[model samples]
Target: MNSDHYTYRVTWSAEDAEHVGLCAEFPSLSWLAATPAEALAGIRSVVADCVRDMSAHGEPVPVPLADRRYSGEFKVRIPPEQHRRLAIEASEQGVSLNRLVSAKLASGA
Candidate 1:
């Protein structure tokens, strides 16, 4: 990553109410979780273990998260008629419904 460009977010969560844990995932990076806060802190030390036993010789190391930018997910509801119309337009344009909607919105449709 260019350090100026991309960002990823990983919200920590326990496996269950009784457990303590942290969870993290990124689009272009690896995923990991810890049973305790200390386990998460141990990432740097344990990363070497993952690399040492790796089948590939040139594997990269996992670095600590430095940025927290995120495009959070939200729900948008549309009437069935509107959805059908968007789908038909998308099919006519040889694109997916999402692509069509994105294009139309970007074009002030």
Candidate 2:
């Protein structure tokens, strides 16, 4: 199976004294190793095994979040005060609130 469809993250774990690899789709599954590469490899191997087993049992594998389609738009809820502040800032900058917020978000601020 192509393991590229899965999401893997490797992070250091002080408790285990090793890097830990986790798949967001399969929260219960994890792998640990002295190095990030080893941890990732271990997790990939385990994921492959899991996929094969699930396939054999006629269980469905989850679609990875990365593989899902998304619309460019989404909604956010902000407090009335915060919304007022942002509206004032956007006005001061001579831009629509959406334009200001979009610019800020794009800049990762």
Candidate 3:
């Protein structure tokens, strides 16, 4: 398997006093090192080993999330009171509820 097909991220960990590498596809594994490069290399090595083991056992490996397509739409459920409040606020702002909610969500508010 090509390691480049996976997403690898290295982030600083204050609690560990080092950089930690994590693979989004393999949530169970992580690696730590003094530098981001070392941490990423360590995780990639681990992923290589895991791929080999899975291949030998005929286990399915997850497809990379980066390769997937996403629709811009999703559904969310809210309490009745919260829904009413949002509807009122949207009306007051002269916008559709969907537009108001989408704007708020996009702004991280």
Candidate 4:
């Protein structure tokens, strides 16, 4: 797996008082540095090393999020009352429940 293809994020850690780099595919791995660039570089190097180690050990390496396929469909369970409320809201808005829920999710609500 190419570490470059993996999803990476760098953000400030208030508790650590430094920038923190994170890889979505390797949730347990992180690198803290004084700067975002250093943090990102550190995390990338760590991921590359991990990938190499896993490969050498005959372990399955994770597919990069950028290279993975998503179906765009998933099931979510909510309480019956909440479901009924959403259904009514959808009906009042003249849209399907899926559409209403999709809008809400897209809005980050």
Candidate 5:
């Protein structure tokens, strides 16, 4: 196993009220919060700690998170012009808008 790289699973649930709900866990880390956003923030903090500890052991920081996966619904507001532009680009690339955006984000990493 690559001790420097870990796979953490984050799960989200709807709350009856306004708060978002989320939790993250791996053999190396665990955290939770009332919202998905909060849970992400909390898990980041925990990962930072894990990284620091690993660094102290004469190890490199965890490998870049290129393979980390995120799946969720999010809303983005773009003007009609920008929306049409992205649609055209997606069509040209033979991919859905979501795939286009995801590919762009991944390439930018």
Candidate 6:
């Protein structure tokens, strides 16, 4: 697994009074530093070490989020009443429920 392809994020930690680095693929791993750059570097190093150890032990390493493929379709459950309401709204708009829902999600609703 390429650690460089993993999803990384840097954010401030008020409680720690420092920056924190996070890897989405390794939710349990984190690094803290006084600077964002250092925090990111630290996390990347840690991830690299972890990957090496796992590989040496014949353990399966996690696939980076960037390397994963996502299907466009996913199932979501909602109350029957809400589903009915959405169906009615889609009908009123002259569109399929899927299209209406897709548009809403795209708009970050």
The CA lDDT of each predicted structure is 0.51, 0.92, 0.93, 0.98, 0.63, 0.95
Error of 3 at 87 (Å): 1.8
- Scored by lDDT, the top model is 4
Better of 1 and 5 by TM-score: 5
Candidate 3 residue 96 Cα shift, in angstroms, is: 2.7
Query: Which 10-residue window in model 3 sums to the lowest lDDT?
Result: 61-70
Candidate 3, residue 13: Cα displacement in angstroms equals 2.0
Which residue window of length 10 is worst by lDDT in model 5? 17-26
Worst 10 residues of 2 by lDDT: 1-10
TM-score for each model:
0.35, 0.80, 0.82, 0.95, 0.37, 0.96
Better of 2 and 4 by TM-score: 4
lDDT of 4: 0.98
Kindly report which residue pairs in candidate 5 clash with one another: 20-34, 20-35, 21-34, 21-35
Writing each residue's lDDT as its tens digit, candidate 1 over 31-98 gives 35544444444442344344455425665534425554456535679999999998998999999988
| Clash-forming residue pairs, model 3 | none
Q: Enumerate clash totals for all models, in the order shown.
A: 0, 0, 0, 0, 4, 0
- Model 4 residue-pair collision total: 0
Candidate 5 — what's its lDDT? 0.63
lDDT (tens digit, per residue) of candidate 2 on 8-35: 9999999999999999888899999999
Off by over 4 Å in 3: none
Q: Clashing residue pairs in candidate 6, if any?
A: none
lDDT of 1 at 99: 79
Residue 74 lDDT in candidate 6: 97
